[model samples]
Target chain A: MARVEVPELPPDPTAATKVAELEVPPEIVAQTLGEYLRAWAARVRAGDSGVLPVIAGLAVITVVFQAISPHHVFLSALNLVNLLQQSAVFMVLAMAEGFVLLLGEIDLSVGYVAAVGGVIGVQLVQPATTRWPWWAAVVAALLACALIGAAQGTLITRLKLPSFVVTLAGFLIFNGVVLILLLLGPFSGYPSLLGDDTNRQVLYHLMWGTIDPLAGWIGMIVIVAGLGLALWLRDTRRRRSGLVAPPLGLTLLKIVLMAIVGLTVVAICNINRANIGTVAGVPWVIPIVLAVLGAWTVLLQRTSFGRYVYAIGGNPEAARRAGIKLASIRTWAFVICSFTAGIGGLLYASYLGGMSNNVNGGQLVLYAVAAAVIGGTSLFGGRGKVMHGALGGLVIGGIYNGMYLLGLDVQWQFIVTGLVLLSAVTIDALSRRGATTGSVAHV
Target chain B: MSDANVARAGAQPNAAAPPAGEARLQVRALGKHFGAVQALSDVDLDLPAGQVTALCGDNGAGKTVLTKCIAGIFQADQGQILWEGKPVHIRSPRDAAHLGIETVYQDLALADNLDIVQNMFLARERLRGGLLDEDAMERDAAETLASLRVTTVRSIRQPVGSLSGGQRQSVAVAKAVMWNSKLVLLDEPTAALGVVQTKMVLDLVRRLRDRGLAVMVISHNLNDVFEVADRIAVLYLGRMVIQDAASAFDRQRVVQYMTSGGTNGSG
Candidate 1:
């Protein structure tokens, strides 16, 4: 039999044949990403969830308070710098709380855990016995806190227990541990090594150290350049994937804001703040906090673990059916919460020059939780961001500082915090109810 | 292109006659119990391809239980559900989805918070990058609705809660269609619809049949049953009393069989 000549393969069989031979009508083209985004925004505006409104209201209130303040120091450069420094520790702790809250869970042990972590770290560099370097001590402190968190996480997840009960237990146990550690002093079997004052100096130097002007400038440049590269890479990937991305103008605006904030902080710290004419720069802890926030934000927003945390928080049964290891995500969430709290604890101790037995747990846990909630994170779970912790913590810290500047008692600060937390939760609950009831337009 | 012509053309493409020998979905002596209560017992039913089979019964007739069992919401205490003649056990909603069986419960189980595209892609979402691929998902959702000729919805972006009863039913039906389900079990889809809306939903049932997907409709409304169903199965007190071709029994006999615990020769 004569072999039939095979037809040459079409360059693109599906498209070419559909156009030339199949007589199929052309498919309707989907909207461009930009066009679709504009439409989506219009829709959001018409029946928007009120997250932006809430955020805007908060900003307006803050600005108005600053404008009306008797002492114009509320908007002064020095005060702003002070505000950033004060917010640093609280931001870390609040963010740690945010991580657990996103999974519809709570961790009450962070306060004491942080205290314990700080105490342990400081004790590590005892000149009388252990001659560990500052970095080593810091690492040891973090490790201790992480272990505490992991232990609590394991108990809650493995036992299928409520986080409220488990973390409550953790709070008591860790608090006792802290007292024990502090009472025992540094864990040295023998004394007579490096002098005590040298150990004290090392601890002080590590916590409050400043870099040279050139080093500071160099560090800022590296950070900005690295951030620029990352943003550019992300934008490129999004575009290549045929996805929607923020407008270039919007991105540029964001970068400019970031630079202004960064440069202003650096410049203020670089100014001579020394009564004895000492060269001043940002506390190294500032950069450390920023780095931690950036890393944790990426972990929470970009990874599968983060997605599962949100999913479980939103609907546990849905997550279970999706084959997500709920227990593992929750455990890790608790672990991060404790770990970050530990960091905050160490920073607080460093800033205070030493950890004390008088460190309050009951009040600290409330502040941390309130900071996260006030930052616009949903207490109900499945809806929160790391940035919320930073923003919320700043707000709470600002209230404390503002009231102190205005000569208000500590009681008023507590009252303001309580009201803010209450308002945030009430707003969250109302919006959720509105969405469920199909009254989103009202929202 | 005229409405009359389209209706005439669609009227008989799917012949009123049942398939000669092929059973699309077969439930063989299915049984289920809740502690002491026998929710279902020895329930046998056959759903044929290109036909709207009505599973009709009163308030406590084990209709919901049987549908749930087939949809894998609840495991049958004893029995085999043969899908395309293969013995299978449906242990979960996901399993039922894999087996091309979709169930629209009484609540419709649609997340009111989510818009049409989101609700349609709930549990099963499209992803282009790392996040929810909104563009791709909306396009696919639009296409799916368009193929079903679901024009009741003014916009897919609108929340399901804003839709009329008929439109919501259409969405639930569309969601099932998106899963490429071979058999869709609808629980009282037209329970709350007005006359015109009910007609719209009935027409949708007919369209589903024309598309060659077996449909098992659970309804209390006999008029809806007589209007759209090709075969009707009646249950009373957790037992299947009669299952017959819709032409075999009129409304009177079907109601009698539904209420009394007696078999009718028409079945």
Candidate 2:
């Protein structure tokens, strides 16, 4: 059955295609920001639409909450400020969740650990007990949380244990730890811990502290200007280096968007929504959240460690092939996650003014995941940002504030949140499908 | 090992290896077993510089097992891997990479969320002041793609997830070549690609050979083997049955050798 003549019918289209010039247009090489934006929007439509749905969902929910309630102040200054304050802890937790979520993993223990950290923190500053300084107390709690995360991550990475099972165990363990510590750890006396003004003051300061109006104004301007400058500088550098930079117009547009949102937030917080005289100015929690957001964003976007996290998430085999230490990156991801959760715990203690045995840590963890997913972090990983969690947390906070103002039951809030989470997950699946099929469709 | 060691070691290609393009990687008497099963046995192969050595076999003919062994995903139970001319132990993928060996898997082994440049420079990213040097990376990636004649991409900044199958395949190969890898192992690079995409990849393979890099392509398709490969090594039941220039065997003969493990099939 040997062929008499060697086959030649394929005719080497390969050679012809190889020799043909690509004819890359000059304009594409020198694309303006406007064209860059158009291309970006097209990419988004093809299914990489980051943060669009969250913003839309927030707007629609605000209007719906306003209409559903008889109160005319769903978007009121006082309510908006309350929403920001409420969002702070959840925002940080959601950002923490984003880390593992991007790695295609989940950390269920964050909520309880936050509570444990908060409890541990308060116990350290128990006035006559451990009597540690507030900063020291905060540092101890964060360290404890990081250690917990490291343990969980180690089991998951080195032991090859499933993250869900490990974190589920963690959820139970930490929740029990909080209860156990409360029963025996420092500041055990309920009244002595809660009754002490300084103990309450230091713990709640993050949640309850406020800055003067002038300070708020200056902070907003500085933050907005700083963000704008950073973005501008980055884009300018890319452009100068002759790489693909976003249009200056797009950069300015984003800065403008940030400015408007920032100014509105400052303005609302400055409004006196108090019953007696004037209770105004931005809360200290706002800046704390921003600082965390900025730091995490840079770590993820600008650093090699952050890039490896995403790489490991996207394709562990590929990352391993390229010489990345999968276990180390994964372990650190969980460590950072738990560490951030520790912050949330302190803020939570501050919000509630005290810790109790039945701290609803489970519900809080669920909300953190919801905030990240709703903000546009995919549950599948490799596609998210800290900012998504922040935005998602605000949306959750908005829904809660609006519904509470309307005198809605906690049961109603749960149903609404569950529905929103379901919607977000559905969107993520659909868009991911779109991404794979979208390219194939063109082919 | 030091750079001096690799350069000195790589200078000595096995004396009895292929009498063609400089032999960069030589595997001798390689054997691998999984439980009671002989996945690969006594497989001898040579990857010469400036040539495409296509590893051809039917399914379960130990093609992938042999590939994994060479890539150091699995250490051979019995055999020696010679890098350049020196006998070297490759216990892991890192060891293989250190020897300038890179494998582009069937999956393309790419991160979808990462852009073309990011995917290309994943673990080996250029850094300035302890941060990712995006400009340097993007520029280097663009230059690599350009040199490889992969001009179909709209932007190097676009995520690899958005790339076409052929484009993705080229990027994966380019990633392997970018690190100055002396040898690249491509596992069925054209398996899921269309005709045009396959052509694109085959051309890239030839371009890589032209650049004097040792390349081994594993493929079931005879047409693809003929299209790009300079030499075709056929495996049958965990053994190297035939090793000859691509022109030495036709489709029917190659198929017969792959199916029946007989020498008489060749013209």
Candidate 3:
């Protein structure tokens, strides 16, 4: 029973004699608080720092745009709130896109699928014919979107067709259905810029409605504090169970950051920024977006389904050998992607006051992919967080909003976004190449 | 050492075989065919508990076919697979796993993006309160690796992609044998390893055997076979060439049987 010198290993052993003095390379286990920080810093240097690059890029973009703008409106409470609202749809869409991206697959049809969902939602709640509650309509539309996703997933998984090709066809077909649906009714729910009375009531409330100020403050505190506690509890449990844990300092830092960001957003939205000066409260969309974001994070991090998603994305062969039902997981993934995209479509309809056949779904899908990629979700898959889309959406929205505040046209916005997207992709490619070539070993 | 010389020397040590007990898995008259091609025919072998049996064969010689059969990656067209001397049906990989059969394929079958414990408890994850019990899994993974004396990795929480080739291989093997698996099959476990890495894997293989598990290692490298194998089984052109204790033979005799199906290195 010779003692094997594994600093990370426990005292338990069977054949420790043969391994004694073998100099088994220590796993990247951090036994102490300082070592954990050092390991994390090393990982960041190794380019495994998930969303840091995207965050840094967003910061740089914000600073530059603020410097060039008239009143540094990038940091203005009103502008920031507007950024959140404007980016909310794209953010949801990007999170949806992250699923397929994580599986090393793509869904080009999500935009139109979303359109179909929105149209169905509006039609189902029509006042005269087949009036359903707003919640019911939302559910029905989501289910319909999921079915479309299942169909596409079946084509891609069972038929073994490339998702690019299948979803590209989906991109055309669903919106074609949207066009036909538009011709069927007068669509009284479509809002008139000059104030139309025929507009359905829920659409008006959902997109523009806000929580009262006191509730907003209370709600923000509860949610923020709750999330922090949940995160902290999870780590504490891991540590208590004698597993590796990040240093307490790191955990506290993360909780503090979450609180700061959450409170800041709440504070900004709580300010009265309307033209007439009476409108002040957090938009209902804010909490909705936050809820979705939170759900996506949980799905990706905690669940067995999430594990399989990463496994499939990382190595399909490995997942297959692990006896995971690759087809089922993949199909479900596509279903989830379209389901979230359906939410994005509803948001888009709400933001614009109606779904149009001419809605730039092609552009919407592109922006979704762009958001995920720019936020540090890998185009190659298996290396992204759902929150990456959240951050990326904010960046994209911030850019557009800041440009609007500077009085720039859509063309400038396009040019700047395209450049940012290009830089992000280049960064991704370079980092991956660096990883394969062992650049991270030194770090 | 000459083929006959190392054969004699290696043969003397483990002739009685299976330090733990009797054969756990026995295959008799196993036959498989892929269309007109006979991948395996009349393959008979015995894998006792607590010993390393090295399966050696030339390309297309049904060595993989046999390993896959035992691992339930493929079902034999004919013949009986007996566990503890009782005939049993092994159909899918899942069935094989249910029977405590774990195979570490040549490619390692690990998600590189995942951390160590995640990779270890991949499909068969331990759960608590309907969620992944991370603490329990981490503790188990650490214990498993330590019990196997696997200490090369700096952190069990680090992604598998960061480890060296040998470390990945070690993790795959540990994952296979950690959960009370009676039989562990490693397909070409050290096929692409360097000298030092190969030695590390061989040591790990011996450690697995000492833990009272039946380990069948597939290797083209005879030196590795000689280093860790307690028993040597050779498959030649989809037929059982020979199955004998390692001390009964050496490098040349095994290669001779592998290529020509000759007995004792003679035509």
Estimate, for each residue in A201-293, the C-alpha lDDT of model 2 and write its tens digit.
767778777899999999899989988998889888887877877667777788999999999888989988788988898988999999899
The reply for model 2, stretches above 4 Å from the true place, is: A1-48, A67-71, A185-200, A437-443, B1-22, B264-267
Which candidate achieves the best DockQ against the true structure? 3
Each candidate structure's count of clashing pairs: 0, 2, 16
Query: Rank order by DockQ, top first?
Result: 3, 2, 1
| CAPRI-style quality class for the chain A–B interface of candidate 1 | incorrect
TM for candidate 3 is 0.90
Each predicted complex: what DockQ? 0.06, 0.32, 0.37
What is each predicted model's overall lDDT from 0 to 1? Answer: 0.72, 0.81, 0.80
lDDT of 2: 0.81
lDDT (10s digit) by residue, model 3, range A1-443: 11245443333333432232112212234445576666556656655566777788678878888899887777776777778888998899999999999998999988888888878777766665566777888899899999999999999999999999999999999878888866656654342211333335676556677899999999989988998998799778776766777656667778999899878888888888877758888988988888899888888888899999999888888889999999999999999999999998887777776666667787788788889999998888788999999999988887878889889987887888888889888887777775631322110
TM-score of chain A of 1: 0.80
Error of 1 at A328 (Å): 4.9
lDDT: the better of candidates 1 and 2: 2
Which has the greatest TM-score?
Answer: 3
- Give the per-residue lDDT of model 1 (tens digit) for A322-404: 44677888888888888898788777776667766767766678778887877777777866788888877787777766777
Arrange candidates by TM-score, highest first: which order?
3, 2, 1
Candidate that beats the other on DockQ, 1 or 3, i.e. the better one? 3
